[model samples]
Target: MKLKLAAAMLAASLPLASMAFAQGTAPADLAMIDACLKTAEKTGGFGGACVGLVADPCIKAAKGANDDVAKWKACAARELAIWTQKTSEALKKVQAGGFTDVIQAVNDSQKTFAASRDRFCAVFDKIEPGMYPGDASYCRLRETANHSLSLIKLGAAVNEH
Candidate 1:
């Protein structure tokens, strides 16, 4: 009877563990990104500011004019995620405190981030031909949209508090 119960528990836990893995939240990665973004966003209105700052220097070091576009773009994508994540965190923090100043910052940054992502999407639409192309532009658009949603939710959460 005990063995049967143990087997049942193990079977149940296997599905639960798989569910967690499928979610891909990676709490440690999320927390680290959140912390970095928080500090970066506080210093600059958007975390992308850090990436933008580096982009120019990286471009100048390249031997060919068009040589670094891919590299720069890849960097931009990473920075965008970091900035968006930071903005999301800031939105939550502001909601926690009901700080009016942070609200404007969050809204403004969200717009900028969205615009950047939209520009990326435009590039994607120009080239790739597919119903759901697994492209960087698509990823950026989704990230920006998610960040915007997070801001809205954070505002509501703060208002409630």
Candidate 2:
């Protein structure tokens, strides 16, 4: 529960994405996802240039600090907010594609993914006391980003046909 408590405290104290930007920690703008997606659309994938566009810089900035793990988690949480937003937009696009069954399945899958992530992170906190919050936040960020990308790809492919 330490990770949960830490995350909650951090969330309450920080408006994550904005804090990351105001601190000059995350070089990429929060709106930069749009450009990444546009590049993905042309390149058929989010290449290295776009991958971790926000997180990489944020994490790098936090490196070597005494509370590096905590800083990394905070950085991940910041980018996670943007990815969460991107997930919503991508979900909407996929839903608008008019594949009722596919949409329903994706909805169910998303719910399950959230539940699973919460459960896994909670247990992970107990198992790895030293790495609780940072690891948890990184897990969340990775999953959210992957789900967002998946939905975007699905939307494009579905609409193509």
Best by TM-score: 2
lDDT against the true structure, per candidate, is 0.45, 0.62
Which pairs clash (backbone N, Cα, C closer than 3 Å) in model 2?
none
Native RMSD of candidate 1 (Å): 13.1
* Candidate 1 Cα outliers beyond 4 Å, as residue runs: 1-51, 63-66, 99-161
Residue-level lDDT of model 2, residues 39-84, one tens digit each, is 7788777533554667667777776535477677776777777766
lDDT tens digits by residue: candidate 1, 50-161: 3333223433454254554455444334334433444444455654555667655654554455446555666654654333232443355245435544564465557654
Off by over 4 Å in 2: 1-28, 46-49, 122-133
Alpha carbon lDDT at 27, candidate 2: 37
